[model samples]
Target chain A: MRTEDFLRDITAIRGLSGDEGPVADFVADAFRPYCDEVWVDQMHNVIARKKGGGPKVMFAAHLDEIGLMVVNIEEDGSLRLGQVGGVDPRILPGQRVWVYGKDRLLGIIGAKAPHLLSAEERSKNYQREDLYVDLGLPPQRVREQVQIGDQVQLEHRYTALQNGRVAVKTSDDRACVAMMFEALKQLQNLRHEADLYFVATAQEEVGTRGAITSAFALDPDFAVALDVCHADTPGAPAWRTHKLDSLVASMGPFIHPVLRGKLVEVAKEQNISLQTAVVPRSTFTDADGIGEARAGVPTVLLELPLKNMHTTVETLDSKNLREGGRLLAQFAVAVNEGWEDELWT
Target chain B: MLRDTLQTLLGAYGPTGQEHLVADKVRELLSGHVDSMRTDALGNLIVEKFGAEENAKTIMISAHMDHIGLVVTDIEKEGFLRVHAVGGISPRLVAARKVVFADGTPGIVALEPNTKGKKEPEMSDLFVDIGADSREEAEKLVSIGDVAVYAPDFTALGRHKVASPAMDNRCACALLVELLMYAEGQKNTIVGVFSTQEEVGLRGARVAAYAVEPDIGLALDVTAWGDTPQTKLPAVKLGAGPAVKIMDRSMIASPYVRDKLFEAAQAAGVAVQREVLAFGGTDGGAIQLSRGGVPTGTLSIPCRYVHSANEVIDLRDMEGALKVLLQFIELA
Candidate 1:
């Protein structure tokens, strides 16, 4: 698949937590061309199964994105919004977004003119309750056009910079999902030993409920979850975020020792560049639940470097996501080739 | 009912690593009822009881015996002892308070008189004065490594309310002992573990959990309530009853375990409150994730002014907890 086409198609669907039906349908459509069978689960997770006569291997990523839920719309065409997942309030003011109404409506967050503001209010941090959206519509017209509880996403147009980075909304896990599709396209005609269950999970942004339920249902012997990692930038805490150019290998209570060892072996064999993020316990990811599900299931987390996450312009080097996909595909191949013979043995 | 024993235990000076005094007191009281008793590496008291069925699932109950105290770091020339907080504590509660060292040496915590407008003195600015003129004189009675806690006399405020020091968790330890005593005739295997160093990151419970590996685990502790003015309005009120926690910041209790507790409370006709604490954690965090996970729940005794020298609780809440817990053990 063309990288540009993959990015556009994956970012087009609106899926936030419980409302992942459209995103699942889009993923199933995109994955059917490369897999034997593609289906969705009761929880709206899209699973594209590649037929194989060997051990089962699952490549999983989340399809949901962090967006806003329109709670109430005021009489003067202003809307009060609540974040569906974690939304950084610092970047929300004066930002343009698309309100997912019956017909898409363009809106911009209305900020008061600084000249009119008093000294006390200006000294404080900006709050979501103090902000509203300007849809450029009359009071009655807006109520007639956009109802309450509609979802809204940032309308920042994708920017492919000279440095090979893609600036867009929902690059967090959506980009991870796109990489899986690209890998499937590349491995279409390959004869594999392990049965591949590629799951595009939903609602991972809101406390990893999608991954938790999916892991419980599948009950795989081993699992890997792909999510975005914080990238180093100006004003970022040096200790928390890593450099975008470096591929961080996470080690912690969330990562199983066997899975971590296997990842290290595969990276060594493939000669890939990798760094490490050592967490004391439970990285607050789907791996927490997957590690303890049904007696236990060993899990690993492979993070794609991202900068300014949970904001309108959450940026990522597209090449980093591509490399992450290569690493994951390599690990899948390694597991598939030696599953019953070496992994269990 | 258990207040006498809890006050006696709380009055004893037992810091994180020096919990032997309180553990020995519990050992003496509960020796006859338990089938066997042993102390773990962290000084956690583990008591066992045999069950009726063969290969019955082991159940573990935990309560930390450590209270927030001050650890001596330096003895200044003027006999003022520089101290560090043994656990998480606010400096506002330390000034002009009475503290007793491990060897019964008395002291008064004081802040510099120059900082008058200070709402609270940082641990660096606070010192304990044991009324000695020189460092040598102070060292005669107290060592540089001695630990001390604020001493508050227990008093009955009203018909059901009682105020005392270390009530934040002495109530929990007392309840565990009472449950062990009440379950002497029962058939199920019970492990009552009085943990240490819970305030220092739940280190004791983690080790105890691995050893127990129980199918069911219950953490007994005190929870905050809206009895005082500063508590958030529309919060859990005092005098209601024991709280059955559905969710807390640290651990989300399994819905199945929550429903079972609720069902048992209904059958016994006990007054119970459903709790959803916005902050603070419990030993339930480690217990729930132990040995590939265990179904866990918390039975909390609602207390006001927790982690303070003068924490208050209602005896009716304790009675309610005992009733619901006895019923749960029978049905679990």
Candidate 2:
């Protein structure tokens, strides 16, 4: 599948943390033709495996996105919100959302107008609890349509930006899912010795829950998790972020150093533009949970630099996705050859 | 025997993301009671007990084995060590507390004496004093990334209350261990999961639940009691038996599971209080949402001064919690 097409298909579905059934189904169907077997696990992680006799290798990408859940419906026809993952309350005012209730309803996150606010109220930041979704309907009708715990996704469509960049609501993960599919497509004809498992893990935005279980079940020799990292934008710190056109290889306490070294080696061998992300503790990705699962499987993180992460206007470079997918395929082949011997030492 | 095990677990140095010591102790305790026992990827010790019936519902009960502690981030001059929180240790609790490293190295967490003004100390202003005279001496005793928990000081506070460090969870671990020993001849398959890294976001419970795929999940943990003077919480108090969790920050207990627990407690003639904690989450939060969602609830032993070195729990509440859980398991 084309990167843009895959991103569009995956982002259109609402896959909130702990509620990733639709996206998992979509990924399983997309990966069916390329794999010898495809299935979804109990945690709703979509696994597609290409059988081989050698050591197993897993390429994981989380399919879930950050969103809000309806916690309470007020008498004034507004819905109280609770976050499914980390959300900046400052960015919530004047945003559009789609309430996935009994039926999809268009809503706007209501913020107090500056004209009506007192100077004291205007000076202070708004708390997430203070914000509510305004679904333009009567209180009775709104209650009938929406219930508590209904997922409210940010309403942003995929847009093709200038300079080969694409914008979406959740490029933090669905973009990486696209990259995994691209890697599988690229490796269609390659005769790799290791069994390749492509996993579209669920609930990563919450706590890497899907990766924890799936990694234990598959028991791969080594694994790689693909996700997005902070991109260097106008206001973002340059030292802490990566460029949009390059892939990021993370080195952290959770990530095995040997696996990180091998990923860097593969990037160089494939002539892919790569950046190094130094994370001291947890990478806060699926890699963190996967690396620690059952004894310990060596894990590496492959990141696509993304702009405006965890926001409605997340942007990423298309070229990075292509090159990242290429690097992943090459890494799979390298592991098939003899990456374990190096990994153990 | 139960109190002894609780003391052993609370005294052990098993910080979040590093729970091998606690897991080892739990493994030894559960060795005789369980049909089989194994540790998972996140260091969760899962002990299984098969039921007599062939087609039985699988039940999983979890209590975390990890606790909050300070990790050595950097060594300062004059033998002080800069520390970072492994979980959610408040800066307010770090000043002038005795701590011990994993290798039994004793130290005192100290802050700069307040000559400037009466202001809350930041974590950066606080350091661990290991009686070392210089940086070299401190490095020789404690290396970077070495974790140290509050020194164990299990004390009897009154007739029924007991005080200890890590009692927020070690009490629950002890409860599960006691349940395994007493709750015999269960109809449903029981899996006792001594989960790890719970203080760091319920990491171990998530995977352990997924691997077990239990029909019903119960978390054994401590809940904050609101009986202290001028406290702004609900009317939960120590010695009130086990708290049947209604809701908390992480999850709302399944109504069916909550009702079943109430029924079990009533049948056992044990008093159970309802808990609606305003903050803090337990392993039940992860277990309830695991897989397609297992019906989950928590049995909270009402604790005072939770997440502190001097956490207190009533022994009667612990005994009541065990009785209710045993009745529930036997009826299952």
> Pick by DockQ: which candidate is best?
2
Docking class of 2: incorrect
Kindly report which residue stretches of model 2 are placed more than 4 angstroms away from their true locations once superposed: A72-77, A101-104, A137-148, A251-265, B1-52, B63-187, B191-216, B220-279, B285-332
For model 1 chain A, where is the 10-residue window of minimal lDDT? A336-345
- Kindly give the stretch of ten consecutive residues in candidate 2 chain A with the minimal lDDT sum: A335-344
* Residue pairs in clash, model 2: A293-B41, A294-B41
Best by lDDT: 2
Per residue, candidate 1 scores C-alpha lDDT tens digits across A148-178 of 4467787756777768888777777788888
Listed in order, the DockQ scores are 0.03, 0.07
Q: What is the TM-score of chain B alone in each candidate?
A: 0.95, 0.97
User: Which docking category, incorrect, acceptable, medium or high, applies to candidate 1?
Assistant: incorrect
